[model samples]
Target: METLRLQTFMVFMLSSCGFVLSFQINHLLYTQSNPTAPQTLDRNDASSILNSNFDSSLPVKFIIHGYRESGNSEWALKMKDELLVHAPMNVIVVDWQDGSSGWYFTCSANTAQVGEDTHLLISHLQTQTGLSLNNVHLIGFSLGAQVAGNTGKRNPSIARISGLDPAGPDFSGKGASDRLDPTDAQFVDVLHTDGEPLWQGGFGYYEPCGHVDFYPNGGTRQPGCGLVGEICHHMRAPAYYTESINSDCPFTAYPCTLGQESCSTCNGNCGFMGFHADKSQANEVFYVETNSESPYCRG
Candidate 1:
C-alpha cells in the first residue's frame, strides 16, 4: 500500500511539471514573436514605429498587404506614416511575399492560415503586454482584405476591420464567403475603388450597411495599365482610412460624383450603386473623391 501511494505522488508531480512547462512555452511565444518596427519609420522613434504590447489604452493597428506587394512598399509605408501623423497608435505590418503579377493564386489557400497567424500575433501581444483585445484594429488591402475579415471573424475581440478595395471575385465560395459581411465581423468597413470584376470586386456582393451602401466614384476606374498606373488606380479609393477609423457604423448614403459614375461600372442593382460593409456607427468615415486623374494617386 505504501509503494502504491509513492507511485501516485510521483505521477502527480510529473503532471504538474508538464503543465508548468506548457505554460512557459506559451509565455515564450508572447515574448519572442512580436515584430519590432523599423527604425526609419518616423522622425519620432517611440510612436511612429513600435513592438506589440498589451496596454488596452494603446491603440493597436495592423496593416496586411495585398497581392504582389510587400509591407515595405511606398504606399503601405505611406499609410503607416500617415496614421502616425493622424492618430496615436502602435502599427504592425504582416509580411507575406509571394511573387506573382498581383494576383497570386496560392494566397487564396493561405487566407485562413494567415488569419490564424494574425490571431496568434494578437494573442502574443496581449499575453506579453497584459492588454485586452479591444485595443486592436486591422486594415487590409486586396487579398489581405479576406485575411483581415477571417481574422476578425474568428477572434471576436478584434475591435475593427477595414477592407480597402477588397478583392471582389477571388474571395468567393464557402471558405471565403464567411469572411466578407458586416455580420461576420465585429465592426466591418469595406471600400471599393473598382467593384466590377466578379472574381475581384472591391467589397464583394455584400451590403456595407442596412441602409447606406458606399459607392465611391461609382465603383469603377478609368482605363490605365502598367505597374505604377495600376498602383495609383487601386489607391484612389478614399474609404480606406476613413473606414479604418470609423469601424463602419451609423450607415450614411454617400453617392459618387457624376463624373465618377460615368467612368464607373454600376453593379446593376437598383442600389444600382456600389456595395459597402458597415457593422456599426460611422461618424468617422471619410469620403475623399479627388479626380481619378489626380496627382495624389498618380504619384
Candidate 2:
C-alpha cells in the first residue's frame, strides 16, 4: 500500500509539469501568430498577419497615401525606413481603395470612401495596438493630407496631424476650406508647395489655422527643375524630408543639373523659382532647414 501511494504521487507531479509546459507553448504561439494580437478585428480576414509583437507603450504613427498612390510609394517607404531610427513605435502604412486619377485633383464618393476606410483602419489600430488619443500621429501628403486632416478632425483618437503641401485647386473656397484647418485637428500644420497655384486662386488664399503655416524652400515650385512651367510634385519629399530647404531648393532648379544656382523668387519663370503658401502666422514657421531663420515671408 505504501509503494502504491508513492507511485500515484509521482505520476501527479509529472502530469502537472507537462500540463504547465504545454500551456506556456500555446500562449507563445498565439501571441506570435496573430498580428493584431491583443484585439483582433472580426472584419478583416488578414488582420492576423500583423505582428502581435508591437510596443504598447510607444506612440503609433500612421502614414496615409494620396488619392492614386499606394502605401508602397518610394517616399513613404523611405520615411518608414528613416523613422525606424526611433524605436518602440510602430509604423503602419494605410492603403485604401481610392480611385486612380490625378490623385491630388479629385473629389467624389470615391474620395469619401478613402476617408471612411481610414477611420475603420484607425479603429482597428486602437483595438489591436492599444493606442489611445494622445498616442497617435498622422502624416499625409497632397490629397492624403486632406484625408488625414478630415479624419483627425472627426476622430478624437488622433493627437497630431501634419499636412505635407496640401493639394490646391478643387479643395479651395469657403465651405470647402472649413474642413481642412489646423483648429479642426487637435494640432494641425499645413505645408503648401504650390501655395496659390495660378489655376486655383493665386498665392496665399486658404487660411485654416490662423497660426502655424510652415514653408520649405520658399513654398513654391520644388528646387532643381530649370525654368519649367509646371509645379513641383516630385519636390514634396525633398522639400520636407530633407535636412534643410534652403540648400536643397537651389539644387532643384527648374532645369535641375549637377551644380546650378538660381535666385530664390516666386516669379514662376526662374528655375526652382516658385512660391507656395503664406507663413503669415505669428508662430515662427520652420522652413524645415538646419539653419535657424524666422518662420516668416522673406524676399
Q: Candidate 1's C-alpha lDDT?
A: 0.48
lDDT of 1 by residue, 1-299 (tens): 54554455334222321111111001111111233344222212234224424244667677777655576755566666655654556666666544212224455545566676677667655655565677776777776777787777777667677776765544544453455555444566666555543422223333242122344544445333222113444665433343333332322334333233433222332121112344433422222333334332210
Best by TM-score: 1
Q: Write the per-residue lDDT of candidate 2 for residues 154-194, one digit (tens) a residue.
A: 67446667676664445666464334566544556555554
lDDT of 1 at 59: 76
lDDT of 2 at 203: 22
